[model samples]
Target chain A: MSGAFISFQDATKDYGSVRVVENLNLDIARGEFVSLLGPSGSGKTTLLMMLAGFESVSGGTITLDGKVINDLPTYKRDMGVVFQNYALFPHMTVARNVAFPLEMRGEAKAVTAAKVKKALDMVQLGQLADRLPGQLSGGQQQRVALARALVFEPRVVLMDEPLGALDKQLREQMQLDIRELHHRLGLTVIFVTHDQDEALTMSDRIAIFNHGKIQQCAAPREVYDHPANRFVAEFIGETNLLDCKVSENAGETFSVTLDDGSVVAAHGLPGLVAGDRALLSLRPERIEILPAETDATATGQNRLAGEILDTIYQGDHLRVVIETAVGQIIARTDRKAQEWPVRARVMLTFRAADGWVIAP
Target chain B: MMAMSLFKSVYATLIVGFLVAPLLVVLPLAFTSGAFLTYPIPSYSFRWFSELVENTVWSRAILNSLLIAGSTTVVATLLGTLAALGLRARNLVLSSQIRTLFLLPMVVPAVVLGVGMQALFVRFGINSTYLSVIVAHSVIAIPFVVISVSGALGGIDRRVERAAESLGARPHKVFFLVTLPLAMPGVASGAALAFATSLDEVVLTLFVAGPNQRTLARQMFSTLRENISPAIASAAFVIIVGTILVALLLLLMRRRSA
Candidate 1:
């Protein structure tokens, strides 16, 4: 990723009495694929629209390549946009749709033709160029829209759930295709989506927003493995939140006592007393299950224990639901393991490094 | 279920027939050989149709009506489409209110508008002229154009316009190349309505038109007052058929575009 090519300085948008987005600040590097990930009404799409110049910045400046673009009209910004519905020009053929931006810029006829052909070839929709948008399938129309956006070779591209209208299979395929296109072109992309998996799969960096503010922004794995806060952890993926009280304070690690009178070591925070309440996030797949007679004693650095209440046989893994002394917990195991039946006595254990103490 | 649907279908047919009965009565009467405008014709002939084409006064009125209606259609469509574009956004309360005010000519009784325009045109000393009639017709027709074009604009996904803008189209270029082309069907329908309104207009034209500026409807009105001529029925039939053809053309255009 290059240095900051687009910056939002305290951007705000208010729709009369309701504030859709409030005081948002972000710096997007050139050639970086950033996904604004959030649930509905989280203002992710609103922020994207503001960057695309569709919506105005009510109280802040949006600088593109270090120049203020707050007063520039959307057309003058020289950006490309792909909409969720694909927004292909219904009146024009696919080739014509792809040629529209070049036509707008008054490009030479021969150059526009070559660029349109190259764009269509990039999306693998070259044969459908003569068809009207209505005559093609949904996925084909989306490719035409993509081709139209890319033909101009704009520096930045904004996508608002571009694959939202496709089915699961096509959506996944398009995600990989778009990601590859971004890698090849080295064009900056700001994608908006509510799907965590999609964001994790495509983005170089993910910004998780809530209540019109970014809760955390980092690499995809960083966000998933080392979330900055409780909201970020819960929003990224499933986690078992357990309540604990601090029992010992080391230099950087804290010894916390779980509800079941078990002591576990977690790495976070300073200035924590022995009696301070904290929340621990435990990943399901990180927990390992041992045979009943084998692990009454703590093995290596494992502490938790539970009896298997049920086992769900997924094709690739087994989901084991356990009833522990503290609470009900879930553990994911490989399907190759010996089948654990209902009501089997089991010892569930996980590394202290896998669980982190999050401030409540 | 079938019996109930049959009864509903019959009821709807009766209502449609009742609405169309007046127009049906005038259509065949245009071909009646007798001088009187009675139904149950004694014989049929083309005498009234020939009279309609030969009469200089009625022909001139028809020509004037066509010219005025054509001009009204062009003016109303351009202004109405522009208004639709200007007022399509969720904001712009004042512009929307002003748009509602433009619809006043459609909702208000034509007599009231005619009286008001008569006063205004008199003050300007242009009352009862072709200019006065064309202006009045435009006022009446603009609301229809506005309504149709607005409907078309509403049906379009506004994101497409934004996409066009992001693709480097200036505001005016976006409107002309992208927005106007998408909304052309609505503009066409609106223009059709405007032309029909101006062509068939009688009450306002009677109040505002000079003798030389009399439209086909006004000419038909005067002919009825003097002596009931089959030529009046011929003119009515022509106007009705012309309106239907224009309306059908609009529907066909919509379907083809779809």
Candidate 2:
């Protein structure tokens, strides 16, 4: 945090008397592609706007390169922003749009022309440089906007759900394109998006936001595998939560008693105790279904007896829902696995290390 | 449905005839060879048109009209555009009240405005001058500019301005480069309306202008009161044709921009 390229210290935003972003602190290192992932009205976009100087900070300080930038105007902030709708100038040609920033900086005409060509080439829009923004297709227009934003060579690039308007295929392609660009240029990018998969795929680290506060901020694998709390666990992906009472606390792991009187060991949070109610988050893919006659007592795995309730085919996998003693548990199996007929007796098993215990 | 369609056509034809009746009567009389303003047309000639061009008084009045209308258009457009920008401010208090105040001159009777302006200009010692007449014309013309510019500014996406700022354009540069270019259509049409408004002004001109500052409308009024000549009809023909030309030019401009 001491060498942070951008830092928000107790930042707060209020519209009139209603506070939207409350007492937030975050540090983004140089060249890090950090994403603020949240649903609508979660203050993610507000934080981006504040950093870009489009919106003023109501409380605390935002620093860039160790200097307070709370009062800096947008033009002086040396930041580039790509809006959701592209926001390309309708009157200007594609090349002119990319050259706008250089022109604003009073660059030499010959230099500006060459830089514009290079920027357009970077986005592969060189052939369409003469077309107006209105004449270009949506994807082409988006590329032109990207070229314009990156042409300025700003200190930071803030994207506000820039691909939200694109189709799924185009959005995916753009995600890859932006990630490659970030890596090639070593750009510090702060992306805001509500799509969890997009965040997981594109971000170096994702800050999960809820109710104007960060629920958790960590690497994608860490956040997905060991979510800090129930909200993050539920928000990040689908998980089967079992209500249980902690019967034994052993620092890194604990044993919890389920509603059906079955004791199962689970990974534990820091402050968990022996007599506290908790929820165990078990990912569906981690659970393996086997025949009722199979014996797994020697494997040191948590076991449950259940009957097949339903089997939903998911193209690549089969989502088998088993009516177990604790509750209905879901397990994913390869689509080519043996047919799991309804009402068939089965045994479900998962390793203790795979079950994460979270506070209610 | 057939009967409704017939009725609509009949109503439209009647309205068109009612609007064009005066022009039908006045246009032919512009070329009348007779001395009086009668519709029977004793003879058809370009005598009145020739007289309009040959007479010094008529030429001076036409020049004065052009000078005043041109000046009024420039002054009204500058002030009206600034007012529209101010009215577009976010969280602006009394926005509606201020807009209504800007538009008040449009609804107020011309005679009432003329009386007030005459008194005010006399007190300021600028009575019966070209400045007084142009100032009076711009007061009413500004509302047209304001309405048109405001509509254009309203249609603009605010994000485009933010886009410009993010690309290192300062506030003034953004206005001159991005905002102004996007709003040019409205400003162009506003300017045309302002010119047309100033050209058609007569009641205010009579109250504030001197004999030397007489405009075409003022001259036509005095000529009508003194001697009802066919030259007055020629002047009316000229004014109507000039207005149509301005409208055509505006249409061409809008088409190019679009």
Backbone clash count for every predicted candidate, in the order shown: 0, 0
Q: After superposition, how far is residue B94 of candidate 2 from its true place, in Å?
A: 1.5
Residue-level lDDT of model 2, residues A17-72, one tens digit each, is 98889999999999999999988999999999999998999999999999999999
DockQ of each: 0.82, 0.80
Residue A265 in candidate 1 has what lDDT? 81
Q: In candidate 1, what are the lDDT values of residues B94-204, reduced to their tens digit?
A: 986788887888999999989999999999999988889999999999999999999999989888888888999898888888888899899999999999989988888
Per-model TM values vs. the true structure: 0.95, 0.94
Best by DockQ, which number?
1
Off by over 4 Å in 2: A296-299, A320-331, B1-21
True contacts kept of each: 0.92, 0.84
Which lDDT tens digits does candidate 1 get at residues A1-360?
125799988888888878888888899998999999998999899998988888888888889998989988888888889999999888889999999999998999999999999999988998988988999999998989888888898989999999999999999999999999999999899999999999999999999999888888999998887777789889988888888898887866778989888888876556557788888788888888887677455477666667888899889999889988889988888899877888888777777778777777
Q: What DockQ does model 2 achieve?
A: 0.80
* Residue-level error in angstroms, candidate 1, position A74: 1.7
